[model samples]
Target: MDQRWEDAVFLHWRIPVPAAAARMPPGVRPDVVDGSAWVGLVGFRMHRIRLGAAVPLPWLGSFPEINVRLYSREPDGTRGVVFLSLDAPRLAVVLGARAAGLPYVWSQCRAVGPGRSDPGVGYDVRRRGGRTTSAFAVRPDPTVRADDELSVELTARFGLHSRFAGRTVHVPVSHEAWTLHPATVTHVVDGLVAAAGIDVEGPPASVLYSSGVRTRIGRPRTVRGT
Candidate 1:
């Protein structure tokens, strides 16, 4: 699969290792750094989705998305993301991803902008016929680059670990390093984290923003066992 991820707002909270590890698949564990594990609530626009060598689905493929995710690492230190939930507005995309074990929820989602009233970029997500929702915005400071260790660790992941047909599968992805800027939270109202079964107090520990990246996700392969 190939697609473009644009105008991403990355909000992350640090959590105990145990709390994150408990959510990992059997053979994978929480990826810990800076003495803790981190969970991210990321919002962005998904554009130009295309199957291998196929034309991009311009309309059906483009939509706003927000995902709650945790980091995972195998015994041999293969790092990846483990999504707890993905909120997208398109029902067709939701159904297709769920069939492959991605926890995609159909929702009313949209991307907001750096307009006159609100000079920050953000996203909004609300579950279909329900109350679960999340809204957040960030002001990226272009003067400073987000090239620190923790930033790279969170944004430069190359794959994901997921469950499919009772087995844990690893799907690799290829993408150039993201161009990130340190950011500050401008506004936020969230419930997606709670819906994802994670609890954290106060505001996000780290906030960053990026214009976007083009990604290519590879085929899934089973882990060594289970």
Candidate 2:
């Protein structure tokens, strides 16, 4: 599958390694840096979701999405993300992703801003059940630089660990190196993390933004330990 993510804002919080490890599935442990692990709440607008060489379908091709993610590492040094929940406005996408063992949920979402060329953007997500919700606005610095240690640590993930058909699996992903801008969280109100059983206090440890990335996600392979 091929997809483009645009006007993305990444909000990451430093949490105890054990706090993140306790939620990971079998075969993967928390991928910690400096004795701490990170969890991220990322929001973006998806575009050009295409299958094979097919043209991008209208509604299916575009939507707003938010995901709750954690860092993880396998025994052999492979690093990846573990998604706790993916909230999207498209029901078909929600259903399809869940069929593949992703924790996708139907939600009402909106993404607005001056656009990619602008320095700020806002996102809002409210799950269908109305129990889970998130809202935030980001304003990125004008200067763009290659990611620093903390930025790279959070965004350079190459794969994801998930359960499919009752088996732990890894799905590889590839994308161009991200050029990030330091950003500020202008405002925030969230329950997405708590909904995932993660406890985060105060504000995020890091806030970053990028125009976005074109990503290609590979097929899943069963984990060796599973």
TM-score of each: 0.96, 0.95
All candidates: CA RMSD (Å): 1.3, 1.7
**What lDDT tens digits, residue by residue, belong to model 2 across residues 1-226?**
7788888889999998889988898999999975689899999899988774366667686788999999989999999999999989898998899999999988899997946576578789888778878899889885767468878888988899998877889999888977788888889999999999999999998998888999887888999969
What do the candidate models score in CA lDDT, each in turn?
Answer: 0.92, 0.88
Off by over 4 Å in 2: 53-55, 115-118
Total backbone clashes of candidate 2, pairs 3 or more residues apart or in separate chains: 0
Which candidate has the top score in lDDT? 1
Which residues of candidate 1, in runs, are more than 4 Å off?
116-118
lDDT for each residue of candidate 1 in 1-226, tens digit (9 for 90 to 100): 8998999999999998989988999899999978889999999999889886487777686789999999999988899999999999898999999999999998999899867775589998879776787889998887899999989888889999999999999999999999999999988899999999999889999999999999998999998887
What lDDT is reached at residue 106 by model 2? 89
